[model samples]
Target: MRVLGVDPGLTRCGVGVVEGTPGRPCTLVAVGVIRTDPDAPLPDRLLRLDTKLTEYIARFAPDAVAVERVFSQHNVASVIGTAQASGVAILAGARADVAVHTYTPSEVKAAITGSGTADKKQMTSMVTRLLRLEVAPKPADAADALALAICHVWRGGTQARIAAARTRVEEKGTRT
Candidate 1:
């Protein structure tokens, strides 16, 4: 399955695309950062993010979009900006008729590095190894986006199967 992962931020939103399935090695389809000027008006920044996210969704044609869930932070401004960017990304996925899933920072870290408390350095190292990249994706954000994608591919695929099985069982019961 193809998954697009987004690490949303006002200044620099990370985007990564990966294609893989559970118990299989994933291939990196693309990775980049969407940058918006901090000085730009809030509406303008959101517009920029929306445009880039829509383009990425169209270009990648992902089966699903995985976004970093916004969490509380000491800096209210930072949290607001991130939540806004995340909203735009989620909207883009919805526009494209793609399912958008949100994962907490701890969930993503655990999925990629096997530790909920893994630091950025550890997550980056694991992402590098998982993708078999010679060098880590730069700007931490980029690596994080890739990690989110990898996490979705690994976990989301299994979740889909479980849901499908439950649906089948429900249908069978209804017929009986």
Candidate 2:
């Protein structure tokens, strides 16, 4: 099963691709951040995000795209931009015929670290250990993306879980 995890922001968006079997750890296919100038016009930033996200969807060909839900800590502007960025990711996935799913920060943290109130460092550390990565996913955005991926993996989406089942079926046939 393959999933594209997205951490959306107006200035910097993070993306990750992960694949795994049912009983094994997820393998990181790719992980990185997409950045735009915060100084740029909002429309321009949105366009840039759209372009980059479409490219990512094309390159990764993910079965599903998992994005973080919008929850404002304090800044209204930041929340608005996050919603826009998330829209871009959803549109990108829609264009590619891939389904999009949204997970809350607490949900992601709980799935990855077994705690809803897990800190960034704790989430990062758990993501690293779960994926067997040598270094933590960086820039916080990327860690969040990886965490989103892990959430979807742990919760089992339709596409991802279905793909995993197919692989198991084929493996069983081969064994027989």
Measured by TM-score, the strongest candidate is 1
Per-residue lDDT for 34-127 in model 1, tens only?
9999998999999999999999998889999999999786268698888888899999999999999999999999898889999999999999
What pairs collide in candidate 1?
Answer: none
In model 2, the runs with Cα more than 4 Å from the true position are 72-74, 157-176
Each prediction's Cα lDDT score? 0.92, 0.86
Off by over 4 Å in 1: none
lDDT of 1 at 146: 95
Model 2, 23-127: lDDT tens digits are: 568999999999999888989999998898898888888878999888767378578888889988888888888988998888888877779999988888988
What's model 1's overall lDDT?
0.92
Best by lDDT: 1
Task: Provide the RMSD of all predictions against the true structure, rounded to 1 decimal.
Answer: 1.3, 5.4
Residue 155 CA displacement from its true place in model 1, Å: 1.1
